[model samples]
Target: MTKYYFLLFLFLLAGESFAQNNLDSLVQIRGFAIAAPRPDGLPDFIKFVNEELAPRKVNTLILRVDYNYRFESHPELRDSVTLSKKDVRKLVDACKKQGIAIIPQINLLGHQSWAEKTENLLKVYPDFDETPWVKMPAKGEYKWPNPDGLYCKSYCPLHPGVHKVVFELVDEIMEAFEAKAFHAGMDEVFYLGEDKCPRCAGRDKAVLFANEVQKIRDHLAMKNQELWIWGDRLIDGRTTGIGLWAASYNHTYPAIDLIPRDVIICDWQYTRDNQTAVYFAMKGLRVVTCSWNRPEIALQQVDSHVRSRDLSNKELKGRFYGLAHTVWSGPTPFLKGYYANTQDPKDGDKTPWNTFKVMFEKIGKLETGH
Candidate 1:
């Protein structure tokens, strides 16, 4: 009788293990990183989320506000058409109901301006510029991403005034949105530790990179928030193809081993670089795959992400946090083109934009399937 009871107990234990091995054990993060809505377009943007994104299970948003908030610390940084506190509050409330997490992003390191003559933070606070004396390219000569253009101005991370205001800006945004995670726009930092700056001259580029990441992470830790950053600059260009938008700062990836593992890396790959996710995950950092412009490629990459996590390996399991569809060009044009256009004229299939939108909608339906 004892032997029989032992055999039955083993059978029940095996059944329990089998049940745990199913798909539900896998984790998925469905997120969207979008541009901050203009004040006039706020209502339409909110309505679109209620009507579309919520139904589609887009549970997270990485909003690129880029000094678009009326800051209490420094009003000078606020753009002419910044989002009011009420607007941010309203967005937070709306996201809460949809089970979505909103992480507001401020361009911390790169993207001082989109174009050569564009004006922004670095242009306003000249002292913060890492290579302030570096002349702007002469009339479209050696434009951005050329490695010599030095298009995007990086603030001297060592400057005292830099963090004083940036931290205040971060504090205000996190408080406004009640965010648990904050995305620091730290990609494409080309002008780091330049010889021009008295403060940062001759400093190790990797140390500068790692120090800045830790500084941001420490600030977030004070509020019990997690730090999220673009994984492009962290990638080694030798093994991976660093694109135009994501420029490597002279191979500063050695900083990866220096920073904390809890920092969530949003590993965005528009091409076959989806394999890069494993590099981050293997290093013990949480990761999310990001895509934009190419829906088929996005879908394929995301599929690969899920499949990688579903494997039996201990390191691979539960590392891929989720998939994020980053619509860098705001939803207005995307929606307009999606509504007016069908598949590509040449290919006779839906445009990449439409294909991506449809995928989100399908996921929403699947989430609430009857």
Candidate 2:
């Protein structure tokens, strides 16, 4: 009888493992991407997570924390309006109660500045700037195709002291959110391997980008955590004709093969149905299809995600992990618009709030078979 019971236990454990694997084959991450709320707006954001996100089954919440948190390790990098540890705990508790995984983001290699204003990292340590010669516009907004060819600034990946400061911020933010994954916003990196920079000059752009990704991934691996990044910089812009914004033009696309496969890529395309998720998946990386402000395209992305998972081989199906709706604005304005049903005549159906609703409603129906 004791031997019979032992055999039965083994049989049940095998069944459970198979069931879990079957479930994992489907869309595993129903995500919502938004900026971290200010300290004052924390309550409302928490309420939204409880009321809106929970009901729709948003399992993954990627909050763009950037420099918006009060860091004990580097208090100098804190933004003027930031979330305190107390504030972070409230948000974390709300998410934990709802079974939502929180992934905190800090823009690492790129997006260091917007228009004329420099971001906190470069402002604090100016020596890290990859293109120190490319100055921001003094008066009006920075224009594209400018003399400096600037879109957003990037820090030199080879800078000796850069990772120490950034990794400190990463560790602190991950600890505060109790996150299993860290989203390093390494997207739209236009300024890399510049000729003028001492360390990175004449070096291979793809290697520089890949090395940085590996470094971040290795750091997270120490704690058995994962690294997530935007997929734009990994596409061959010139060959694919996906253009510079959505893909890479600076020859960094080849880095796709060099980086660790465990890194999750958030492949975003707003205007049209760009089926680049397949590219990432085929390349042995798990990818989430990200959409912004286009409900039609967002719905298509949802269908694509489901279809890819359903049709692909077992090896590739799980790599097409899920879909995420990205909100480019802050939580306060977005939540206000979402609740009020606010729509501009000019935008029509092209709004992130509208896409958020449509995307999740479709996800809810798909998951339930309704």
Candidate 3:
């Protein structure tokens, strides 16, 4: 009877081990770090990675190399600007040392402007400007605001030549950094089937995205690489309301199965109640929860969101990959200003420097039930 009991216990342990490994393989820890800050008082991106990010078992760093503020229209602007190759190298080296892979994120489809300060890429490739929202008035200036409040000039996804340009840019970035995964910025793609574009007028919105995703996926696959995309646009109508959320929202568009399953879905919600991660995972897609640097309220939200997602999803419990905290330098543009905002004592005294610290402490409590 003791032998029988021992044999049953061994089988149960093996089953648990298999389940744990399966979940761990799917859960990727996504993070956004200041990889290429301007020259003035650049924080050692490497030091931060080594000291902060690595210990958290963060497997992926979504390095923000955005062009809207850093460089516009001319990719060549990267040459004149502040972030250097050496800075990138240091970060990449640190990432390698820490066993974390870098997936460099360049804003490709939209979020293409910091303001009118930089010349628009759409201006150079007018054929590629896919936004039906923006009517090019007779005077040639883009129709301001475009009915929607968000300021975005979308590149036409239908244009074959546009893919060529995008591929070229992707190729350049891939060659420069040698990262295995590339984050194809497909967030908030409002202009799915543009009204004026004859090429896009009659196509299904879901099909349009699927085709586009396939195009990038095929390109990356050829180069022996993979792609990661935002999960907002892929929520299926059957499981959830299709138009339940505003079009601007991450979960606003179609079904998860619309895109290829291989593509990583960055399930993101900056709100305190981060229920989106659970929904995404339930749909049989991999998920990564994302948060941003906000006020003290934001950290409270993150804590709540993390706990909700982690505890609520039992089948996907260990499958709940990890969390991503973004340090956005938008309103707070300067480094000191950003540091102050994230470091504000009210922020649970938890800045980016201390996020991992808090995370582990919470994790320890979760593990210990203390």
Candidate closest to the true structure, highest TM-score: 2
Point to the candidate with the largest lDDT. Answer: 2
Q: lDDT tens string, model 1, 238-356?
A: 55566545536476788888988889988877655447788888888888887766667766765677677866287657777777777767657766665677656665444546656
lDDT of 3 by residue, 81-187 (tens): 54555656665777788878888776666655433422245655676767544544433454545554435556767777877666776776666566998888677
Total colliding residue pairs, candidate 2: 0
**What clash count does candidate 3 reach?**
7
Candidate 1, RMSD to the unseen true structure: 6.4
Decreasing TM-score order of the candidates: 2, 1, 3
Candidate numbers, best lDDT first, in rank order: 2, 1, 3
Per-residue lDDT of 113 in model 1:
52
Model 2: per-residue Cα lDDT over 209-318, one tens digit each: 99999999999999999999999999998898899999999999999999999999999988888899999999999999998898999999988988888889989988
TM-score of each: 0.85, 0.93, 0.72
Model 2 ranges with Cα > 4 A deviation: 1-25
